[model samples]
Target: MSEVFERYERQYCELSANLSKKCTAAGALDGEQKKQKISEVKAGIDEAESLIRKMDLEARSLQPNVKAVLLVKLREYKSDLNNLKTEVKRLSSGGNYLSARDDLLESGMADTLTASADQRSRLMTTTETLNQSGNRIKESKRTMLETEELGVSILQDLHQQRQSLLHANNTLHGVDDNVGKSKKILTSISRRMNRNKWIIGSIIAVVIVAIILILYFKLK
Candidate 1:
């Protein structure tokens, strides 16, 4: 039983780390970091699964009596927990803790199995409760691991969006620079065209004046 607990704890830690890494990777803006986190998550998940298999094996090796006792306790605990949950909900809605606590205690079963119920029954009940609680705790821890993974994924998405925005900004700035260069080239071409028009006009006027001077000299 103690070994089982130890195994469960080890797996819990591994699972948590894996989930965190996954979330981090998913949200990572950097490709390299995202890749690394993915690897870490994979390794962690594998390790946790291996630990779970070992725990299952240990559980199966226990005596039938122990298993039966555990089942009975689990059923009882579930019933009690469910009732407590309902009462808690009701109390919460009305903002009344005092009444809720009273209801919980009244519904709860506290060490009710006396010594007369046979040693086998007692042992089974105790072992079953311990094992079931342990399993439930482990499951809850794994749930947290999943939550962490989701968080990492969200972060990675944000990172990617930031990168994309930066790229777009750079592209827009480049376009602006190109447009400015094109405008300067167009202005220079316009100025050259104006200078050429003045030169052509002067040449035409001189030709016309020469023809008129020649005709007048011949007549004289």
Candidate 2:
């Protein structure tokens, strides 16, 4: 379960890094660092969601008490995910509209510029929505951190429960060690399948050639 959390944390950090990279690449020098920080927080939400899913899957075969904690966390994470989605849509729509507005301004269309401004004004009404979305995203990140803390508590509970029940499960029991070997085998299979594609074409070509030769001989 902690493994799941760790994976999510890494992914969250990566997402924040990616978002920061995007801001920097766009020449947002003054605010790039700030944007990156916000992105990091937003990424934390993602990390929490991933961990919740992993926990849910892992908890399915566990005891009732273990399942209950995981289920609660999963539900909380899902609720947060939904809210984050709404915020994302709000921000993305505003960002897209602004981008379009910039394009319109750059196009140098005297008639369209007035119309574009009108459209931009309409987008402005959604300003609160954008701000609210940002707040919600931030809130979700905080919630995710709370969820992670809860997970630690639940994991400790699970450990205690296991001790009482004498659950003799190894963490590595479900892990597939031959993943790389499996990938290699899949690649080999794919290559063999692709070879058959050309073989069919060659067979068709040979058949056509044979038919022509037979026809030519019969005509002669």
Candidate 3:
């Protein structure tokens, strides 16, 4: 790895880890304290973004094989960063709404019917928000599952293709072996034909010579 890439990657990891801790800590805190931690997280997010950009630039500058691997890692980092931001937002919104509801319930108001109406309305709103968040979580899970299944399907296809290639290669080898055998058989047959031709010629020549000797004897 290049020095710049290594440095930026290390820094990004540290920053993201710290942001995750902050996000988890924010869940334990409330009011101004939680808000402060969120602010800090947002700042860290900005810094992480900068580091990611730098790392991307460095990764792109590398060789193709190395660049692909590094870019994959960078995408994971980006996903994690996005998740962190989402979590922080969820925590911030939930805490603020709950805190406000609690304050309202604690107030000493004389209009009991209006207070009841307001409380019911706030409860309904909070319930809707929770439902929306739950729906979003469910959707995210579905998407992740679909992605996993797709990856598995692609791997299976590649495996089948590899098997097909191996089978083709084996068949080709068999054909080559048959071709070699056929060549040897043809060569042997050609040699036998040549030998038979020579033998036939010698027999004809001997027959003609005997005929000539017989005629000469008769004439003598």
Candidate 4:
């Protein structure tokens, strides 16, 4: 079970790192390149999710106690996976594509706008494309902000869990210490009782001997 969780964690980290690299490169990439990278990242994410589902199923088939930790870790991995997906979508819809499209439109308009009728038509088309791109950019920004907020919430939850675990561990340590002290006190009491029993028995034996000797002397 631990091995399966480790494997899942390794895959998750690899996918996340790869996605991070692609996101960094996305801004520098041309539209076609960015699109290709996005597709590849999406495929990687899908593969990771498939493996996670397999691991989750395996965990569920185990005994309840054994499955509990795995289930918790799996939940965390799922949250991270969601964050990664949001990041990839944001990177894939970056402003680079919009900027490139605008550049192409401007170049084309400059070349064709020598004729007044062509200029008017080109201007209308360019304006519509710009407006559409702007709307998309706005939507993407909104989505990215929402995703960021969710990621922050997940981090906070994880932090709280860590703190709770730490407190539980400390409590267990205190219990152990108390148990050890109790054992020592019991051992001391047992030793004292044994010594007192031996002493009392010795004193009784001596008194018996003294009485027997006195009776023998008096009778003789």
Best first by TM-score, ranked: 4, 3, 1, 2
Instruction: Kindly report which residue pairs in candidate 1 clash with one another.
Output: 23-152, 24-152, 26-156, 27-155, 27-156, 28-156, 69-124, 69-125, 70-128
In the range 38-85, model 4's lDDT, one tens digit per residue, is: 788788888878978887987888889979977876775666566556
The candidate, 1 or 4, that scores higher on lDDT is 4
By lDDT, highest first, what's the ranking?
3, 4, 1, 2
Query: Candidate 2 or 3, higher TM-score?
Result: 3
TM-score, prediction 2: 0.27
lDDT for each candidate structure: 0.55, 0.53, 0.74, 0.68
For model 1, how does the per-residue alpha-carbon lDDT over 17-64 read when each residue is reduced to its tens digit? 345335433333335654565555555555655554565455456777
TM-score of each: 0.44, 0.27, 0.45, 0.46
Off by over 4 Å in 1: 1-126
Q: lDDT tens digits, residues 30-89, model 2?
A: 245535544654665566466556756766657788678656645644544454444333
Worst 10 residues of 1 by lDDT: 109-118
| Clash counts for the predictions, in order | 9, 0, 0, 0
Spell out the clash pairs found in candidate 2.
none
For model 3, the superposed segments whose C-alpha errors exceed 4 Å read: 1-108, 111-124
Specify the highest-lDDT model's number. 3
- Candidate 3 versus truth, CA RMSD in Å, comes to 16.5
